[model samples]
Target: MKISRWLVAVIVLMSVSMTASAEYLETKVNFSERLSSSAETLVVLVPADTQELSLSGWSNETAAQINRAMQVREFTGAAKQQLEVIAPMGLSVDRLVLVGVGTPSDLTRIEAEEIGAALANHVNSTKAATVHVDTSLVSDVAENGRISASIAHGVDLRNYRFDRFKSEPEPRPSQSYEWLVVSNSAAEAYYADLQGLANGVFLARELVNLPGSTGYPAAFAEMARAALEPLGIEVTILGPEQVRELGMGSLYGVSQGSQHKAHLLVAHWKGSDDQPIALVGKGNTFDTGGYNLKTSSASILAMTTDKAGAAAVVGTVAALAAERAPINVVAVAPLSHNLISGEAQLPGDVVTAGDGSTIEVANTDAEGRLILADGIWYAREHFNPRVIADIATLTGAKVGALGTEYSAIFSEQEDIIRTLRTAGENTSELVWQLPLGPYRNVTSSRIADRRNTGSPGAQAGALFLQHFAGDTPWVHIDMAGNALIPSASGIHPEGATGYGVRLLTEWVKIYSAE
Candidate 1:
C-alpha cells in the first residue's frame, strides 16, 4: 500500500470536498433571490372587481402578456378564481397563478388566510411541485410576513384529509414539493410560528372528525395526553372516582348512561404563576340525548361532533404550549357522551354541579351545558382564573339563529366580550355578543338552583353556563353554528372546522402581553 504524496493529499482534499457538499447553509427558512428563480409556479395576487390587471412583480412587457392572456380567458380577477398561464414570456417560472384579492389596499388577515388557501388549492389542482409567492404588491415586511405565514397556515389546513375509515382510499399524489415563502425582506420566523399554530388546529380537526367509538371520553383523554404532555403541559386525566369525589354530579348524570366512563382532562401550562386565564369546554363525544331522546334524525348523525368544544380548548392550549406563550393557562375539558340506558338521567332529574349549584334537567339533550357547568366551575374554583371563557356546542338554537355565520358569544363583562371580539375579528372566526343580563333570570329553576336549558333559546345556553362562572369575568362561546363546515372554504376543509383554536390562541397571545 505505497501511496504517492500527491495521491495522499488528493484523497484528503476529496474527503473535505464531500463533507463540505453535505453541509449546506442552515437557516430557519430559505428564500429564493427572485420570484421566478427555479420555481415551478409563480403566484400573483391582484385586486378584484377592477378592470385593470395588476401583477406587481412582472415587468411592463411581461405584465402586458399576462394581461392579454387574462383578457382571452375572460378573467376578471374574482375571488376564488385563478388565471393560469404556462411558460409566460420573460419569466423563468414554469406556470403563473393569478389570484384575486377583493381589494388589495383593504387587505386584512382574513383575506390573507383565504389568499393562502386559494394558492394551495391552485397548486393541488395544477400539480405544481414548487411554488413561490410574489410579495412585491405588499408594502412592508410585517404585512408580508403575516401574508406568508397565513399562506403556510392555509396549505397546512388544506393538506388535512380524514380518511381513517376508507379501506380503499384513492392514492394521493406525493407532495414532495418544497413550499417556500420566497421573499427578500423579513425573517421566516413568523411563518414558522403560524405552522406551529397549524399543528394545534389540525389536532382539533382530527379529534372532531374521529368516530365516536374511537374518540369517546377515555380515548380523548389519552389523545390530549399524547398531543400535549410531550410539550411540557401537565395533563391530568381525572377518572370517574376523582370526578365523583369532586361532586361533579351534573356532568356525571349526563355521562353515566354510556358504558364509556367520563373523564375530566385538565391541561395546565404554567409558564407564569400569575393568575391564569382559564378555558373550559364541553366534551360530549357522542350524544344520544339520554332518556329525553333526540326527536330529529339529523341530530343523531351530527352527535359525534358534540366534542368540538373540547377539541378547540385542547387545540388552543396545545398551541400555547408548543408556541411557549409566556403566560399561565388552565384548560379543563370535561368528557362525556349523552346516551340512553337504564342509568340515564331522565327529564326533571336534579343533580348538583361541581360549583354546588343544583340544576334540574329539563331536557336530557341539553347535556353539553350540564357537563360544561362542572368544567367551568372547576376552572373557577381551582385555577382562580383572571378570565374564564367556556366554549360548547350547547344549543341547536345558536345554529338556527346564526346560521353558520358567527359563534354567538354572551358576556356581561364588557372587557371580556371586547377581547374575544377582537380575537375573532383578527382570526376571521367571528363572534357576536348577544344579551346575557336579561336572559340569566330565565334559566332559574323553581325546584332546583337553575334549569339545564330554557325553551331552547340561544341566550339561555350562555345564561345557563354563566351560573357556574362564579364572579370571574366570564365569556360563554356557543360554537354550535361554526363547528361544522358545509364545504371547503378559506382555511376550513369540508369537515369539522377547527373554530376556536385561532381565536383563543390570538386572544391569549394578546391577553398575555397585556
Candidate 2:
C-alpha cells in the first residue's frame, strides 16, 4: 500500500520533534565550561564512569605521539582515575551523569552511540528539556559527524513509543537532545542527510508497526503514490487483470487465495535519461501460508509484517525524492496476500511468470520469491535497468545463516555486490555476501522448472532466487534477517527496520553517475 503525502509530512514532523527532544552532551577532558544551560540539571562525561577508559591527544598531537603517550605509566594512571575527581564540580543539575570515552584514538561510531544512549537514558529518566554537549576535544569532522548521527539515531529509535491512540501521551516524559560540535563543519553538513535518514527510518517503522487491517495492499499503494506523485514521481498500479494481461502468472497465482485483489505498483523517478536502477519488493500484505498453512501461532500472527520489503522500497523512493537525489530509479512492488481458500494455488502447481518461465509451487510459504520473480522480470523487460535489486522476507534460511544483524545478499555480478556491500556498510545496514553458484546437490530439481527449497540443510535461499534473475545484474536481499525487529536497534523500532532503503538510495546516487 502507498502512503499519502499528508501523512508523510505529519510523520516527518513528528520524527524531527522526537529526535530533537533527546539531549546529548559531548565534551573534552580538560574543558572547564558549564555543561548545562539550566542550573537544576547537568550531564557530564568522565573516563572512569564507563566500562573502558583511555585518552588520545586531540588536534595538533600526532597519532604516533598519542599512541606512545597512552603507553606511559603516568598518563595511563591519570586517565584511569580522571573522572572520579571531576564529578563534583558540576552541581547545577539535579543529577550529574558521567560517560567515559576510552582511549580517544579508539573512539568509534559505536562508542559514540553508547555514550549518546547513556546520556539520553539519564535525561529521559530525569525529564530534562535540553542537553548541552561540549565537543571541544573532537578533531575529526567526518568521524565526529558519523558518531553523532549514530548516537542520535540510536536514541531516537529506542525512545520511539507508538502512543498515538493513547489519551495520556502528553504526560509522558520527553527529553530534547542537541549536540554542540564546536569545530566540526562536516558534522553540520551531514545534519541534513541525518535528518532525511531519520525521516525514512521513522516512515518504515510506522508502516510496519500499523495493524494489517488498516494497512492493506491497496491502501499501501495509494499512500505511496500520493506521497510520490506530488513530487513528480510517475506512479502506476496494475490490477489482477492488468497483471494477467502481462502474463504475471506467478504473482496472479499467489493472489488467488486472498480476498484482496493483487496489485503491481510501479513508481519512477527519472532524474536523468540514464539506465534505471530497478528496486523490486515482495509486498505480501498478509500471509496465512496459503495451502501449506502455518502451524505456529506466532508465525501466522506475525504475517502482518510481510509487506516490510514493499515499505522499504516506498520509503526509499520517498527519501530520494525528498533529498532530490539525481538518479534514475524505478520501484516495482508485487503486492498480494497469501491465504488458505479453494482458489489457492496448491503444491505441485506450475505457473508461468511474466518472462514465460514456469515455476513449480513446492511450498506456499515460499511464495515471496514467486511474486518477486514477476517483478524482476517486469523491471528487466520494461525498463532495461542497469542493475536490479529485489528486497524481500524471502526465507528464514537467511535469518538462520546471518542472524538478525545483517541482510543476506546474493548476486552473480561482483561489481553490483561490491557497490551494495559498500553502501550497506556506510549506512550500517551491513550485507554479508552469500554464495550464489549452483551447488550440485541442491541444484538438481526433480519437479517443474526449479525447486524453491534446496536440500534440507541448504542455508542460502537468497542465492536460490538468483536462478530466476536471467541475465540482469541483479542482487537479492533476504531482509528476513533485518526487516522486522523483535526489539529496537539503531534507528529502527520494534517493527519494520527499513533495512535496504538508505543503502539503496546511496547506491543509486553513485550508480547513476557511472
Candidate 3:
C-alpha cells in the first residue's frame, strides 16, 4: 500500500523531532599517559618550523618506521596540515595521523583548538573507535589541561549535525567513537565549562532551524520555559495585554498583523546576590516584511531565522542556568512575527516605545529593533541590571559588509567589547567592532521621535536600538550576516550557525570567572 502525504508528513515530523530534540553530545573526555600502542589510531602532533620529521616520543623501532613514512609523505608540523601514516611493523597502534601546529612561537589558544578540531575531523572520516591525541607538541606541561580542553572543545563541536529530514540518511562515522586526550593533567573543570557552553549553542541551532509554524513567538516562549525553568531559572512570559499595559507600543505594533500572539519572555538566574547582567534578544519568529512585504522568495524563505537573537538568548540563559555558575543573569526576548495582515501597522505608522519615544515606521521589516527596544527598556525598568547586552539578526547592511564570517559589535565600552572579542577568538564565532558615531541626526524624524530605519544603512538598526539602551553600559551585536551558514564547517552544519550563543555565554561567564 502507498503511504499517503499526511502519513509521510507525520513520519518526517517525528524524525525531525527525534533529531532536533536529541541531547547535546556529552563526549567523554579522559586523560591518557601517552599515545599507547594498543590504540586503534595514534594521532601525533608536530610543532611548527621543524627541520626534520622525527617521531619525538616513539621508541627506535616505531620512530624509524614513522620516519620512513614521513620521508615519503613529507609530513611537516604546519598548522592544519595532516597526513596518515601506517607503521607496518613494531607498533600496537593501527594508524598514525600526523597533524601540524604551525610554529609554536606564534600559536594562540584559539589556533590550538582549531588544530584539535582538524584532528577530530580527520579521525571522524576514518571512523576510528578510539583515538589518542598527543598534546605535548601543542603546549608545555603547565598548559596541558587548557590545551587539552581546547582540543576537546573542538572535538565536541565537530560532532554536532542536523540531518533528521532525509528519508535515507548517511551513516555518521564518529557517532559512537571515544575521544582521549594525551595530557598528564586532567581537564574536568574546563570540559564541564565547554559542555555547558556547547549545550547552549546546540539549543540555539535547533531553534533557528525550526520552521515558522513550529517556532513562532508563543512556541518559542514555551520552548524557553521548558529549557530554562527546569534549570532553576524563573521564567516569566508576558502576553499582549501585559505588554500593552506597559506601553510597549513599538513591540505590539509589529505583531498586530500576525495571528500568533506576541510575548516577552524573561528568564532570571540569580546565582549571585549582586545586580544581574541583562541580555535582550529580538525574537521575530518569522519576518515576512509585514505591510512592506519582502521582494524575493529566497529572502522570505530565510525569514525563519529572523529570531536567531532570541534563540541565542534562550540558549545562553539555559546554559548559564544549567551550569549554576555563581553569577546573576537575566535574559529577555520579545517574540512575535512581522507579517502581512489587515491589522498590521502601515509604512508611515507611529508607535511609542516603553521608554516613551515615538518611532515612525519607515520600514515594517525593521521590526526587530522595535521589539528589542521594549525588551531593553523593560530590563532596565524592571531588573535594573548592571550591564545590558542586546543581540539581533537586525540588518542586511552589516551582513553585506562582513558576510557570514564575523558578527558586528557596536559598543561604547572598550572593556566590554574587548571581553566579547576574546570570546570570539576562543570560540571561533568571531566578532568585529563597528562604529556607532554621533549619527543620531540621520535616524531623526521630523514628525516622530525617530524613524524605524533611517539613512545610516545598517548602522541605523544599531542606532535605533541604542536609543533604548540609553546611558547604560551596553553592547549591541548585529548578527544579520553571521546567523546562518551556507554550508557545513567546524561544528555548524548547513543551517543555523548558533552565532552568538557561545559568545554571549562566555561574555556573561566573565563575571563568574572574576
Best by TM-score: 3
**Candidate 2 structure quality by residue, lDDT tens digits, 439-510:** 645634576666555653223355455655678788888878576767644444356666777778777776
lDDT score, candidate 3, position 359: 91
The 0-to-1 C-alpha lDDT of every candidate, in the order given, reads 0.75, 0.65, 0.76
Estimated TM-score for each candidate: 0.86, 0.78, 0.87
Residue 393's C-alpha lDDT in candidate 2? 79
* Tens digits of lDDT, candidate 1, 74-168: 77766556788889888888898777655445667676777667666667776555666665554455655565566556665665665546798
Which ranking of candidates, highest lDDT first?
3, 1, 2
| CA-only RMSD, every prediction | 10.4, 6.8, 4.8
Of candidate 2, the 10-residue stretch with the lowest lDDT total is 23-32
Using TM-score as the yardstick, the better of models 1 and 3 is 3
Worst 10 residues of 3 by lDDT: 13-22
Which parts of model 3 are misplaced by more than 4 Å? 1-22, 26-29, 32-39, 48-60, 86-88, 92-94, 102-107, 134-142, 173-185, 511-514
With a 3 Å backbone cut-off (N, CA, C), the pairs that clash in candidate 1 are none
Ranking by TM-score: 3, 1, 2
